[model samples]
Target: MGMGRRPAEADTDPFSGGIFNLNESFSDRIGDYLLGSPNLSLPVADETFSLHPFPVAAPLSTTNQETRASNGHEAAEGYDMGISEQVSATCSCSSQIVVTFEMVEISLHLVTAPKGSPGRPSQAAAMNIEEFLRDHKRALVSCEMLLGCETCSCRGEYVMLVISICRKLLHSVGVMHREGLSEVQNRDSSRERGGLWKLDDEDQAGVLEVLLKIRATRLRRLVTILDHVVTSHDWPAHRSMTQDLVRRLAEA
Candidate 1:
């Protein structure tokens, strides 16, 4: 007799004629459907489904490593750029400071006077007083010689005028020296008393005024001496010296 198959076993059998194979039939129908309707899509075993194209995500470990490497490279580049900028700024500031220092030095040189220059007030004052005293003494001697000269007949009025000028210059010098000594003594006494020795503006102005007046008087006396020498005609050499003195005084 032929072996009989059970209903459950027949349903489970792949070769059963009543059963349909969905895998084979669906694959064949999918191609037909895609061909008939150009927009249709089918599911595939090795791919993920999506409405739009997208890159497949990698495993978390590999993705994290790649990201970290990229971030480290970017950070290195940024750090290098920052260091270069800071170096450039430091160099620029150093150069600016050097230039500024040079400018300040040049300004100081321009403002300060050289040593031993005639513009120094103390030196000028001492030299002027010495020269003035010498010139006055010489003029006095010249006038006396001319007055007593038997070779030339000198005018009495001119001789008297020159002598008076010389005497007046000598008197002014004596008075100025006495006043200066007194002022020095006063200053010393004030310092001994523990007082600060400061010159007031008004006192400075008054001293300057007196000095100007003294210079004016000296100039006048020099002019009188020159006039006497020219009018007396007794000393040609002395006339030249007097003229030189006048020129020096004017220059001063």
Candidate 2:
């Protein structure tokens, strides 16, 4: 080698190669852009990951404070997401390649302050929320296969999106003609009544403790699901669904 020789300059980023920031849009984030999503068939969970949401035997409790916080919710902060059912996964040694399955929640909890801001959960809202959460949890889940990085993340985003939409439906349609404290109890007669429902804690604290631990496999499932949505152009159909969810959650 010659002395004082300089190294050659590369034209692309090491992590992303030349693909970084080439496309910019919600759709791009999910599919055809850097994610390389199929750009088709992402609505149904079945076309991406192999696992789909399944019904829970019993409804998980949402009366606890810590749990609410982990879901990025606060009473003053408005809407929140709770883990009504966290999905779990396993690995298949049978293939001799260490394939994995993801564990995530098939169900969620959406609590609404019926009487407006600072309103305590009324009998009805509480009752209704509980029932609604359980019913939605019971809805079946399914999935397909996928293979990509950004596409995987897009899949996760879509999964988050669908769940968000479902929660919004609960608030607007789940409890109608209900407001304030009365709303809470009537819907969830089983909830421990007459206690303060605290709503000011960061997510990932003690909030997620009740559910089983999340793993990469489960996250993989999420990515796969979102990728399907992005590639297949399901966002158009999911537009209102996700928008409503964002609106309601933002209110809370």
Candidate 3:
């Protein structure tokens, strides 16, 4: 009879279920699974467990060597590893980024005195100029309403209103003259080059021309009315006031 084959050894690896040794106690198998047997290589087994730190890791020098070898760089053999470590340390310490911003305001048409020493306008003077402009505009509107009113039959009241508005307008003009803004001395200078006030000379001239035409038309109307009142004997009390209004309008 042929020799019987030697019995196969039992599988001792805890990873494999102990099927060869069915008589083994459950507690014994569980203890071996938790503590591991001497036959098992702990380093190799540790690889299967991810929660624990690595049993063996590559050294920094070795990793750098492998990187240099793989990259085929111009670094010479046995290059100092401290250089890379120093660079990494520096970058880690001061890696933050910062930015800065600033805001400024500028004006092109800032007003200044025409006759005085070249200097910026004072706050009070600027406010006064603005007030004058506002008052002039208001007076012009008031005079316009008074002149256009047809319901008011009293010509004396009309003359008084017109005279009051004209006085306010003249006062504003006086203030402007005192502020060195009414008639700038360099008004006849080259249009290409001028101070801040003269920068928009052409536009101002156009506006002034239109206003002058309106004034001439209004004066013609006044003369016609005055002529009619003079020739007619009715409303004799209104003659003097009408003449005074006419004179004020002409002066304005």
TM-score of each: 0.25, 0.23, 0.29
Residue 60, candidate 2: how far off, in angstroms?
Answer: 31
Residues 14-38 of candidate 2 have per-residue lDDT tens digits of 2222333122122112221111123
Q: On lDDT, who's better, 2 or 3?
A: 3
Candidate 3: misplaced stretches above 4 Å? 1-127, 153-159, 178-238, 248-252
lDDT of 1 by residue, 1-252 (tens): 131421122123222222222232223223223222334344343332221112222222212121113554331111222233343433232222223233333332322334265443343333232233333333433443344443211333333344344434444444445443344334323332111224443443344334434434434454554556555554454456556545544453
lDDT of 3 at 96: 12
lDDT for every model? 0.36, 0.29, 0.34
| Candidate 1: C-alpha lDDT | 0.36
The TM-score-based order of candidates, best leading, equals 3, 1, 2
Candidate 1, run of 10 with poorest lDDT: 59-68
- Ranking by lDDT, best first? 1, 3, 2
C-alpha RMSD of each candidate structure in angstroms: 57.1, 21.9, 49.8
lDDT by residue for model 3 over 205-235, one digit each (tens)? 3333333233333333544454353335344
Cα displacement (angstroms), candidate 2, residue 41, comes to 40
